[model samples]
Target: MALNYDKIVLFGDSITQYAYNVNVSPFCLGPALQDVYTRKFDVIQRGYGGYTSAHAKLMIDKIIAHENTPTSKVKLMTVFFGTNDSTGPSSTIQHVPLETYVANMRYIAEKCKAADIKVVFIGAGPFNAHQWWPTRPGNPHNRTTIQAREYCDALVALGKEIGVPTVPMWDLLMEAVGWKEGDPLYGLEELSAENPLTEYFVDGLHYNAKSYKIEYDGVMNAIKQAYPELLPENVPLRLPEWASLTSPDVLEKALQ
Candidate 1:
């Protein structure tokens, strides 16, 4: 298919916002943004902190209304949420009612389609109480592996119905680590000792640096796989050499 728009907007929660404030190589989605479209596409991070899909629906409409100029067009957009919804007291591991999650995603997909914007949906990643050590007894803050997997499956099914691409973020994370001891989600190695080993959030809700990298990488990989025509050849698939030269803490400071 031919390229659609000149701009790519990233829409989601804190995970999408990490790139604007962090330089931890993995946490940064700027590289991926540039890679997908070279200079032709500008990746704008429109993610809000602590937002669920319910909130993202508003953000999307607002962005479209604000930027709906004659020359403006959105080629692509990605939406990721559900962590917050899963953390609610009444929420089960299966998430804030699987039906509700599907409904929210469908709503987003419909609006994007109407605008002629390609939409990509990402499922929630795996969360293991056994892997993550920083959780309460009830695992109240985090969803279980079973729950995460089921939610992702539901999202994927929704993607099929809506005829949009669905990136399996949860599957990618599981393939990358899969409850491994040294995995950042639950790893306790000296390298990750200073930083918390929990999946993404300091409290199991929001994301930290490590989780940011994992999610960003997964999202980029998905974009490349599904929309290769939209990306430039010179753009890198991995972090640049310089990105690894700086210490994580120093990189974090620079972003501040």
Candidate 2:
């Protein structure tokens, strides 16, 4: 097979890894993007479960190496991290200091830019600290909505400083569940598992199928607003429209 496909790589942690897993999440972002792009671009999932931005920074080159071919081009890359990196100091392994987190993100973005690929950053999603902490017991990787907000803000700021596009995952997820910042329990009760909004998240930490769909929409919206040219509507399809065929020489026209 010819390695000539333009690629859009989704690079991140568990969320990105499970993006293509229909069994786990019926709303698969990779497949959704594939449907939109059709044969115009290959959407590649490079998700590493439990990986922090620091870890990703170390492996970015290897992760992107396959698409560095002369015949293949990396058209866009989405860097979704901070879920694990936001782990508190008590969680030694996964915990990346806030300063280091910003630096790691910048490094990753710079690497992508150096490769001539457009990059977008996705902020961490919402989590229920009270529910999450008790479930994990001694695990301090349990991050609160407040902490995630800080990281998300940092990501947005980094995006502005570095001139990269960003998807506000934290804010968008909260909006999806009708959550507000100052409300008690961060308004967790409003979107409790018993609530209809619970369908968006299986656990308070990870997204379910419906939640993934919301996330997909947010990402597409970001791309549309910041890089409209990259939108599927603007990109030409891989071949001629089938409905336009009026003769047996359709294949010849498509090849053109």
Q: Which candidate is the best by TM-score?
A: 2
Q: Which pairs clash in model 1? A: 26-213, 36-231, 201-206
Question: Model 1 over residues 1-256: C-alpha lDDT tens digits?
Answer: 1132356787877767665665443446655556556546667778766677777665677787665546667777887776555544455433356678778888888888888777778777655453444545554434555566677888888878767778776666656554444455432222243332254544433455665667666666666777766555633333224656567765555334
Poorly placed runs, candidate 1 (over 4 Å): 1-5, 23-27, 88-95, 128-142, 178-217, 233-256
Cα shift from native, residue 245, model 1 (Å): 35
**What does candidate 2's lDDT look like per residue over 29-94, in tens digits?**
888998998877889899989999989999999877877787788989999999888877877878
Q: Rate the local accuracy (lDDT) of all candidates.
A: 0.62, 0.80
Q: RMSD, each candidate, Å?
A: 10.9, 3.1
Error of 2 at 126 (Å): 0.9
Deviation in angstroms for 215 in model 1? Answer: 3.9
User: What is the C-alpha local distance difference test score of candidate 1?
Assistant: 0.62
